[model samples]
Each structure stands twice: as C-alpha cells, then as structure tokens.
Target: MMTSDNERARLLPSAALDVLGNDLLLRCASYLDADGLVQLGRTSARFGIPQAGQERSLANEAARQRFRQSATEDERSRLPKYDGESDVGLPVSLTEGIDLEADWERNINPMFVTSSYKSAVAEQLRSQRTAKWGESNVHCCTYGCKDGRCDWTDWDNETGSFDWQGQEELEVSGTIGLLLDLDEGTLSVFKNGLCLGAMKEGLGGEYCWFVNVGSLCTIGISRGRAPN
Candidate 1:
C-alpha cells in the first residue's frame, strides 16, 4: 500500500500536467526527472509508459507552439516588469525577504516539506557535491583556486571561530551570501535569507549556487582585485 505522501507525490505531476495540460507540463517536467514524481513514478503501478508517452506528446511542435502563443499573453499580464537589468542593488537580499516570509511560511514552506521535486533536486545537489569534493569543506572558491582546492575551514556549530583569511575580505560581487561556512568541514548548506548554498566555478568562469529558492541558483562571477 502506498503512503499518502507517495500517492500525492505521484499525483502532483499528473495533476499539474492535467491543469497545465500536456504542453506546459512537458516543459515543467523537463526540469524534473522520473524520481521527481516522488517514488510513485517508480513504484506505483498507476504511472507507466503511457504517462511518458503523454509527456512526449506535449513536447510535440503543435502543442508547444499553441501553448507558447497562449502563455505569452497570459504570462505578460501576470509577470511584473523586470526592467531588463539585474536587481542587484535592491534592498532585499532575495525574492524571499521578511515581507514575503509570512505568505511563504503559510504556503510555500508546506510544499517544500512535502514536495518530491524539492527532495529530488536537493538529493541531486547533495550527490553532486559529495562526488566532486569528497568530504572537504565546501567553499565558494571564487578566487583563483585553479586546482579547485582551498585552505578555508568549515563552520563549527559548537565552538564558533573566526576563520576568515585575507581572501575573505576580497570584495567580490555577484555572490549573494555564504550558504555553507567552511570552518567545520561539513556539507551542510544554510538556506536562510541572504545566505545561499555552496557555489563552484563551472565552465568558462560561470558560477552555480545550489539554492532551494530556485531563483538564486545561478550567479555570474566577475573577477577582479578587491577595491581599496
């Protein structure tokens, strides 16, 4: 017998697909995987090859184009003006600030507690970090750590320490805040407001920060000496 969480997890993608229909669902599911449907897609008998076919049908050109045209107008009305520039100077650290916390606490927090999509992404990030760095203390590595190793220390919950080196004072932009402190040599990432997860340099100086908030995940790095 499937648990309620399992059943709901399996049904979520399907229900989302049902409401968004096949086309939008496919786009949404593209960011997701089979395990993204909770364990239901894997263990439940209700989901199978047919659902996969339905997902593919939504990916077809006709469906995609139709959704795109309809969605464009709908999205325009719903989405606020972005002004075509980064809102870095904005007073709030992220989209989830103190003002938005009340609504998020009531609505979004519950979903994160129960949603399989959140769990899947979190697990994927955890695995990726473990595989890449082994048991080392995860740091931003924004400076010229060419070999991908740093002398930073991890944070200790019990005994706090001032672990900052001269490198920490180097003012770099595009980094929202520290997610995981390197003083304690643990893999825990703090997702509090203004605090983000570990960021590592990707191909071509691109930086990726693992954020549960979705919007704060990708951060572009700019290299330069600290401003005097």
Candidate 2:
C-alpha cells in the first residue's frame, strides 16, 4: 500500500528540515533574525509543513531575546507585533493608517550581519549629519518621512539639489534594519545590523515603523519596520 504525501509527512521526518527535531528546529530557528525566521516560517507553511507551534515559540523566544535585558515583565507583556500597526500611544495619521502587510515582508537578505543594536553608531551618525547639515529637515509623521530627504544621498552641485536614497541605493554595500526602543520612545536606523542614529521627528511618545518603498528617493512607513 502506498501512502499519500500527507500521510508520509505525518509518518516521517520533515522534508528538507528532516535532521532536526521539533525542539531542535525551534532552537535553531531562535538564532535567526526576526525577518529570517518569518521568511522561513512562510516557506515552511507553503510547503505544507505544520510549524504553527514552533513558529510561535520562535517568535516568543526572539521577542524575549530582544527585550529580556531591558524591559520589565509588564513591558514585555505589552510588546505589540513588529507589524507597525499597534502603537497605542499615538494618533493614527493617514500614513499610520496605511496597511503595511506587504512592506514588513522583506526577506532577510543574505548579507545581513546579526548583532544587537548599539546606540553609539546612531548617535555618532546623527551628530555627524547635524554638524554637516545643521539639523535634520526630515519631517516624520506617525509613519515616517516619505519625501526621500530623510536619508540624504549625494548633493548635485549643478542643480543645488540633494539626492535622497534608501540604504539599498547607496553605493556602499550594507544591510539595513530598524531599531525601535519602545522604552525610550525612540526609533533609530541600523546599518549592517548596527545602530546608525535616532530619527529626529515624527517619533517619541509613540511607537512608529518606517520603510523606504518604490524608488531610491522614497521613504515612508508602510505601517511596519526597517525604517529608512
């Protein structure tokens, strides 16, 4: 008697994920960055792998890893989905109201270097940018600044215009991540998984998510993370 794929799946180990037991698989998954784990979960689901419990476990563990050191139990309990929609402390502007289901779905790039964010990089960059440009003219709303000016690129001498570009558009090679410090009401940029600096406006007193969509110059919160 031949077994159906579903039956075989039930009777045997997972198809590409075989060598790993559920707990072991989950443990390995715990090491993945939030985005990586999410992508893996999605891929697993699409392949008919039932990892609901394991995925939840991975997420819980990741959340703990993110907040275990600094957050109180209460704050940990209050952590919302990194999905960018649950900032309870702020007004919901049109940008914040936009659906971010697709934006947060970025695949974990192969180049990412996993590391806990440090405030020093962010502060240093902010100070440098400020020294060079005076103050950040970026106007971030509940979502974030979309005018492409937030992440300033090259300044054109002929047009006297600044070229705004997302991290991916830069000539340098690096990975970008969003660092949200809910306890501090701060949102900072992370480059290659390190803090670049805090964004000046449209943050604080509320949790906000940021992203750069469409063009190199486009910067806005699609209602999620990885603020540009």
Candidate 3:
C-alpha cells in the first residue's frame, strides 16, 4: 500500500517521473502544495497539471483549512452588526429639539407641527419627483464590508470613513446629496444643490442609502417621502 507521502516521494525523481502519465502525476500532485505541484509539472512536459484541479491536492487542502480557521476567528471579533447607514447610531431631530427614535413606523409623530412637516416634505418630494433618504443632513455609513477590512468604526468614527466598492466614480464637487425618484425607481446625485444626472436606474424594493465621506466632508439626508 503506497501512502500519500510515498507517492509524493516517487514523484521527486525527474527521470523516474517521465514514464508516468498525466493521471499519475495529478494523483501524486494531490499530496503537494501549489508551488510543489508546479515544480513537479516543470520536470516533465507531459505532466501537465490542470489549474482547476490544483485544489484537489492534499497539501493545498491543508492550506485552505488553515486559512479558513484564521478568517473565522477574525470575523468573530467585529464591533457592531453593520446593516446600513441607519445602523451608525447617529442622532437626528425632525424638528428643533423634537426627539425621534430611529425605527419603522408610519405616521409616527402625532404632534400637529411634526405631522405637517412630514406632509410638506412628502409633497415636496412628489412635486420634484426626487426624495432623499433619512431626515438628518449628515450621514455616516458604508455599503459593503463583508470582507472584514472596511469596518466603519475601525476608521474615523465621526466621518464614517471606510473603504467601499462602488459601481462608478462619484465626482464630488462639494457636499453631495443622493436623490431618488420613487415613481421611476431611479437614483441621481446632487453636488452643492446641482443635479448631476441619474446615477442608478431600475432600483426596486426598500433600499438604504449610505455615504462614505472624508475627514472634513459632511453627508446629509434631506427629508422626502420615505419609501414603504
């Protein structure tokens, strides 16, 4: 019974390996690391190791196991469950000194003035066919951070500075605002109150807007008809 180690040992001799075919070479390579397999392949032009089958090697499997174990430990040490911009725990007041809890509730504020503000905001959003997410002017949030490197709190906490993969480069002229069209399901960006055309189109379902700004910049969410 030839053990895996013995099979690997048999593959070391360049002269002896010339007689063996590709199938035998792959079987021997299974007990070798990626680099070791490549080295074995170079010994014989006939011993062509398929790139896709490299992971099938036992040594490479061991390497994968070690990497997964380390990644799991790091993932467990995260600070907060990042859902979106709303998860930043920032404070926002709908009116002057009026406290508003961040949660899902329709017609939340019963006060006449607050209700009027909501109505006016919704009306304005409908009239312009544009809506801004969140009630506050400043937002600190990121889109994707699943790799564990782009933690929002890990960077500057105030500005919500974090790395994110975006579809396009947003030309930032000044404090930019993201405006969404509820009817057409399109999204556009406004720089210093100037419309910069539509950024995204065919947006559906409930979507959260996130902004990653520099140290000195500010991100604000204008009041508009809240998506339901």
Listing every candidate in turn, what is its Cα RMSD in Å to the true structure after a full C-alpha superposition? 15.7, 16.9, 22.3
| Candidate 1 structure quality by residue, lDDT tens digits, 1-228 | 657987899778766655666445445544432234333234333332345434322223222343344444634343222333221112111122333334444334433321133456445544544333444343233322222122322222111122222223222323433433234332222121232233331222112343233232323322212222
Model 3 agreement with the true structure over 1-228: per-residue lDDT tens digits: 656987778767765756876466546655654455445445543443224445333333332333343334433232222342221111111212222234323124333222133556434433532234323322222332122122222111233433333333344434455665656766555445556455554454334554444344333345432222
Number of backbone collisions per candidate: 9, 3, 4
Q: Each model's TM-score, in the order given?
A: 0.21, 0.26, 0.24
Error of 1 at 111 (Å): 19
User: Which regions in candidate 3 have their CA more than 4 angstroms from the true location?
Assistant: 1-173, 216-228
TM-score of 3: 0.24
Candidate with best TM-score: 2
**Runs with alpha carbons beyond 4 Å of true place in candidate 2:** 1-16, 46-228
Clashing pairs in 1: 153-182, 153-183, 154-182, 154-183, 154-184, 154-185, 155-183, 155-184, 179-196
Q: Can you rank all candidates by TM-score, best first?
A: 2, 3, 1
Best-fitting candidate, scored by lDDT: 2
Ranking by lDDT: 2, 3, 1
User: What lDDT would each prediction earn against the true structure?
Assistant: 0.33, 0.41, 0.40
- How much is 146 displaced in model 1, in angstroms? 31
